[model samples]
Target chain A: MRYWLTSAFIFLLVTAFSQEPPSTGFLRHLMDREYYKEVVYLLEQTDYDDASLARKDSINYIKGWSLYSMKALQRSAGVLKSVSRESPYYLPAHFFAAYNHAHLGQYGTAGQTLDSLRLENSNMASLRAFENAGIALLQRDYKAFEDRFNQADTSYYPIKKASDKMLDFARDLESHRKKSPVVAGAMSAIVPGAGKIYAGQTGEGISAFLTAGGLGFVTWENYHKNGWKDVKTLLFGAVFAAFYGGNIYGTVVSVEITENEFQKAYDNKILFNLHIPLRNVFN
Target chain B: MFLTKVSGQPEALHRADSLFKEGAFFEASIAYERTVYLQPESKVVHRARYKKAVAYRHLHRYEDALRELDRLPLFSIADTLKSRILYETAFNHLLLDKPEEALWNFRRLEKTREEPLHSSMIPLKILILNHNRKWEEAKGTLLSLVDSMPLRPHKKQSWKDSIKSLYDEDSLPKNYSEEKAKNLSRFIPGAGHIYTGYPWEGAASFLLNGAAIGFGIHQLWYKYYFTAYITGFGIFYKSYFGGMKRAAHLAEIARHNEMKKFNDKCSAMMMRILK
Candidate 1:
């Protein structure tokens, strides 16, 4: 292991193992440099069937973590869960794998992973309860949220702020009102931009009102001056008709889009609350 | 110590070479990267960097290839590799849609006192210039390339004559003026589309504008001033301005496409003569 002879030894080892993949030393170097994508690629090329148990744990942990960084949640969960129980990486891997499943909306699988994890340290039990509570919030099971959250230590540093956000979200969800697209369309039909305002687009609704009402006024002016057969009267009348029809259709669509947007924003917050605690505890 | 360093370095590099020969570019790039990282000051480090770039190119990671090539010690690199490194850099830039950067490196290679280097770069230069709308330069380069061909005088003269004819006034791509096209469409709707080689589109645009204007004038004659102004004139104004913008865009596209087509023909003729 002398400094000068390290290169010679590495040379001999590489020559003797020419058929093998790149060394774990090189892979660890890639990890240190944050070359997660290359690490994933190298791990894929490597065959560790005859390799030591320690090396297997190292390779799987690296691959699992890299895939997690890439947001390949399903594969990350699978890889991380495969980190053997005896390996030091097993506990963090189990927690991340469970979170990945919950993020992917497989709450049953996520709960199962958590259920299977055997906590060695007392702090891990609190972390597990907090994670379960997060999954409950994400799944919109308020009763389960109450039960799981009460068991979790809200004062735990990693879950502290996230715990407060969870309470606010619970209150918001209880008060959340769902808008009806049919009502929005009917409202728009009665008043140019009324439906859009109902759907949460006040500015768009006001713009629609001015544009449609302006066209209506122009059509009336042309009709009053030149009669129905006047080209200007007919053109303005036709344009106004199209605008009125399109406005009603657009209001209904906008209401539906707004509803989806609100739902997505809420879900992202839940996912964030879940993510911050895990990253805090592990990283 | 020297023997140990020599054995260690080439062993890693040889693994990369083996992967490259097997067409396992993804693996080769990793191996070459290992060589570069572990042997940063070695003479063969530049070779490792170059090989890594080549592997990246094979993987269709042109940006990554360019990054690896950029790490080479430009001043101390062998003259032969320096020329090739320039070529590879230009090739990657071209693949990345950076024709200006590609042309800069190709021009540098043109300065090398290497005949084959010029011969290799000339065709690529013409192709790139043609696409970039440097028609005159592409023609001149093609003609120079023809003059340098080792062919019978009669055969070479015939090939050069064909190339010249291809770039002649009537045969050359029409350098459509986008400003002129837009102005034409301003004064006469659809005229720009015709100039840019789409007569049907021009006719449709003209009809739409004509209908809107005719309606406005008819309303005006009937004393419906507000209708004439708000409905008919408003529609006409929007369409007219929109047509002018469209005509300008079409003119630019027509100029690019026609130039590209003409260049391809010139390239084909040069290839035949060179063959």
Candidate 2:
């Protein structure tokens, strides 16, 4: 009779324990193993009120990091922003939040966040300077970037090297030729297709020259043969005038487009350089 | 052990079914997979596998869905259930763009059973045939299916008329012929482009060629034969002939694109019928 009672008790115990909800520790384990999908599922099913303060911070951090890895930048930023200042993970969470902001093209917000980090050591100061330089570069303030970069201590050789490379890149960008639409229009007015050639569009320049010159020649020949009274002469004259005016206008537009294209390409290169230093220093 | 297995199976199935009903296909598939692993030898296992396959399909993981269906033992399931599995297998193949494989499975089902689900297979078969450019067979199959539907004579005649119109559109004659296009431009430098519906290009070609020929003649009259032949006439003639050939090729391509448009429209209509 005692054996039967003990068996019943053990069975009930086993069943009760088996039905218990999954613990936060197991969720952390899944996160540590990089089972992100399972972490997401388990985290959604968990009640945060049951966890301790430290566990709650850990959960939020892991969830934010996982979402960042998944490229859900806005959600990651929101969750990381919730990490309280007293938590041990707060600094790293803030750092990632800055990066997420930068990735979303909010360079000003990213710079301010990095600036707000309390610099307790030389390493922190250097990191702040590096991120500040990145923001300056993205903002196209080369002078400000150089000032921040030169002030950063050179104890970290990688940071020193990255800063030096970026300074040279900024100098190269400053040296690149920039076109003016007004100048291009004036040049084309003097000679057909000259503005396009000045904007580095040689093929288009040649085509414009041929088109304008061909129409002008046809108009002149028609006027010479048929006199001013002929409708054919007037028609050719009007067509030639329209094409000549269009060539000058088109050259101005082409110059603006060329400048815009250069700016886009240069800006992308600067953004790439900015992100590279962050990745190198942080990783 | 047997009792434990029997008791555990329902819990897993119920959880999976709840997840499935909640539109959590990925999690439901995972849960159903776990249930299948727990009771691999039970008859309920087949149902679990089928639902898992369905979950994968909902997730747009057709290859995984087909993999699940492939593991199903057809001999162990009832005929009705087996036919449903076969239909799903064919549907997955169709989604994967493997129309030949889909058609083969669909035909297998047609030979074995005539269920309500099997009725949907006819439109899918027509789609496959049309996609493969087997228009005549698609038409025949469509007409037969329409005839089998319980509709009045006028409604059936309307369906026949729509199918005929689709067939005629698909088989419409090419508006431009390459041979005629090339010959027309050979006689008149820009005529071919105009024939092919490019009047601006025709004008450009005519003006450029006329200027070159006139310049060449004037140069020859002044006894500068080298400039006349080499610089003026030679390049002009080459461009003129090349433009003609290009216009002809473009016309042929345009005709092909029109036929493709018709085919795409028919395919969309057939898909609508399936839905």
Candidate 3:
């Protein structure tokens, strides 16, 4: 009787250990239904140390996807990277990790991740080429973008169409006139607001010109009427000098701000184009 | 058997309720939403919907909460549940600064309900009236509320006295007059600003007008009449009249700010009484 009872007890333990936990099933259901917040909450409360290896991978993938959905890019990348290569989810995990890095502008890391995939399929290779071109566009290396884009197989219509569009964008960017802050500053120093006009800010240029001209006229009038010995003449001269200097400095700063804004807008456009093909193919 | 039958629904609702109790409102809202999706036709769906709206309100997503409330079929619900929904809807409107809508709903509740909610509506109505700056209506409501109270003679007298004091505070005299300020500055440049309680500005205005006139006279004495007339005298005349206009503008601003403070204080006192 003792032997039979001990065997039954061991069998029950084995059955319990082999079967998936109820919570894991529930978490999967939640994730499938897009109940992301609840999935995250459940994951926080769960102790995964003793969970089976398969279950652990599933949990990490779900958590990573949840964070990604919520736009927590860095956290999503870290969690997705924790899934081992041996797991069945390894490919998707790596793909999302690279996507997250790309979204964060970590182009080099993202490129390395795609390279590690060693893509055997032409579709994936085309996708990588598109992403590489996107990276080059973000870096403002139009030549490199063209080179990478031309290497992709045109049989994939999406890649062909996207590359055509990007090539045109790159051509435009290559011919675009880039402003230099140093040049802007020098021009403004020579003639107030001239640099702003060069940077295509005609209104700001005219305003600066009017202000400095008004101050200069006031200084000249005060000195001509009251002589240099008068306090009014000296005060007006001082005001003119301060305003002239500020105008030069403001022109330089405005040029730099405009350049930065231009680059940011262009980068976002490139990133958005790169994102579309991936969603079309994968999502 | 029962647990297995309603497995996901019960667990989700329980977790949502637990989170709600812990004041994790955003998470609770999500959890409640899951329960609604899991069992849309369940008897507890109305309760879940109500709790979700409450959670959104606590999260300060007032518009979303109102949308949730609007989705509920209040006509089919129990009378007490319907009343609770109406109360929540009115309270949300009050928070959203739609005082007229809140007052209408509160009055509806008063007409339909008995005792507690009816009594509670009186204070809320008074509070809303005050918030809308209808001080006369608020005072009348307060007086009626006081008269309807079952308090002892002394307590009733105290309430009436408090209401009277509130009325007196609201009716206090104006602190600044634009006409008076303009007249003062017209006679003596900058005296109006001083009368409106800006001493430094008054001094500055006085010195500026004094300096311009002094410079004008000096230039004229030096036989530079053209420069004196065009620059010094022009500045003096403009500054003198500008000072008067500025003083009148300042007085008007001061009076506006004083009235705003008075309104804010009355609102605070009304809020305290309601609380």
Candidate 4:
């Protein structure tokens, strides 16, 4: 038995030494084929048993790229943050980082990242300008939005179309906000709900104007009676004051809500292709 | 069946072991299977079976490997070997997404050990319980385990530091009272933050509301009517209706969670007190 064990050990030792190491090319092949999720998992579980810089860099690059594909912006940012500036994958990492920041609505950070790459990435200038216009619109800086939109290159079909549509929508929203506030206030001053109608909130304007006017007439009539004197008159006065103030406030809120709703609808239509002509995934 | 007759079987088994060590897993499995059948009672045969299971796991044939593990009980295996099998079995279950079964086996393995349990097992137990969604129970277990861990050598400091973190998570205060905050904030701006023990935030909200109202009045006085109106509108809405709405939502969440926690704690306490 002892002699047999010795012979077997010797034979296995020889066989073990002859075995080749596993190939690293398999992961790259999978990635090139766009089996992205598979590559991501394999990269996540890549052996960190050896604490080498080259190994760490490869792992980090794979993670950053995979997360970019998955559209997990914040997590991708966290993984990509570890990559050094001098690495071969550095430029790609910066591009992804900027894209992620934009998706997160961190416009300033996204712009900053883009600015850093301007010397090398002149091709994205039009894209940057287009996105800048979007950020300006969100900030309610109409002047900045106009400036960015005008300067944006018309050669890029997507950005040009987006900017043109946004320019119209922004102007429409500004006009609506400016007009509704004045029109609704004047209508309320005249008949209450009529102001709501003028502001295009016809139902609310009519209700408010009618309620206030009716209440004002009732209180004036009641105060003229001999039985209910100072206290009842004072109570009616307070009610009148509240309705008067509330009518004004109500008109403003309605206009704001309407404008917001319109803008939200327009944005959804543009950003999510809600009203756009496109071949959808489900379709 | 004779002792001398069995000596020839070890040669084949050893050759299989060599093949396995060399990473030729498929060939090794076949050889090990033949050896085990040839000398079913030998310890060497049982060892070969264990190695076969390892080879299967490495090859990612987890289910097939786990089957061989289930067959090991019929053989007379050592306590240490049994522990390893149970551990590996539980790990396989985890890989298969059978966390509950893995937890059961892990617990069984824990119970079999004597004084001074392995530190690695504690964290593994906590993780398994966490996966099972027994968070509070897991927290309690970790706390007790941290307290009992040996504080001896320099190398053990890393373990101790980890245990300290366990204690911190377990002992964290449950102090988010949404109901109280909402109730307080409903009638007055910034009151919710105060009720929730966020005094600085409460103060800031009050100051902000006051400043907004003040700015609106100043704008109206200066004849910037549009600015004044918008600012005034924001102040009134935020202070009264918006504050009330936020408080009510926070209060509802707090009340529901607190009631659940109270009921669960009382039941658990009653069980302990009565027992």
Most accurate candidate by DockQ: 1
- Residues A70-119 of candidate 4 have per-residue lDDT tens digits of 87888786666565565444545555565566567676886676566633
Prediction 2: B-chain TM-score: 0.60
Q: Is the docking of candidate 2 incorrect, acceptable, medium or high quality?
A: incorrect
Model 1 lDDT per residue over B29-60, tens place = 87787887678789888999898898899999
Candidate 3: tens digits of C-alpha lDDT, residues A1-283: 1232223224333434565333434444455666676667767666667866656666677778788888889988888888776655666677778878988989888878777875657877877877787788877877778787877775686666766777777877888888988999899988899999988799999989977877776677667778999986797689789999999999989998887887787777777777676656655
Per-candidate DockQ values are 0.28, 0.11, 0.12, 0.02
Which parts of model 4 have CA positions greater than 4 angstroms off? A1-96, A99-106, A118-126, A136-177, A180-183, A198-200, A224-230, A253-283, B1-275
Decreasing TM-score order of the candidates: 1, 3, 2, 4
- What would you estimate as the lDDT of candidate 3? 0.74
lDDT per residue, candidate 1, A93-184, as tens digits? Answer: 88989989998999999999997999986578778888888788777888998898888888888888998998899889868988999999
Superposed model 1: Cα runs more than 4 Å off? A1-22, A32-37, A218-242, B1-7, B18-23, B112-118, B131-137, B174-180, B223-230
Candidate 2 chain B weakest lDDT stretch, 10 residues: B1-10
After TM-score superposition, what is the CA distance of residue A103 in candidate 3 from its true location, in Å?
2.6
Comparing candidate 2 with candidate 4, which one achieves the higher lDDT?
2
The TM-score values for the models, in the order shown, are 0.85, 0.61, 0.75, 0.37
Give the Cα error of residue A144 in candidate 3, in Å.
3.8
Model 3 scores a TM of 0.75
Cα lDDT of model 3 by residue, B1-275, tens digit: 01012366888899889989999998788667667767888867777888889898998988878888888887677666667677777778888978788777766665556655555656666666665667778787887776666777887778778777877754642568889999999888899999888889999999999899888788688765544564578688999999999999999887767656665765575454544
- The segments of candidate 2 whose C-alpha lies over 4 angstroms from its true place after superposition are A1-53, A66-75, A86-88, A154-161, A227-230, A281-283, B1-16, B19-123, B135-275
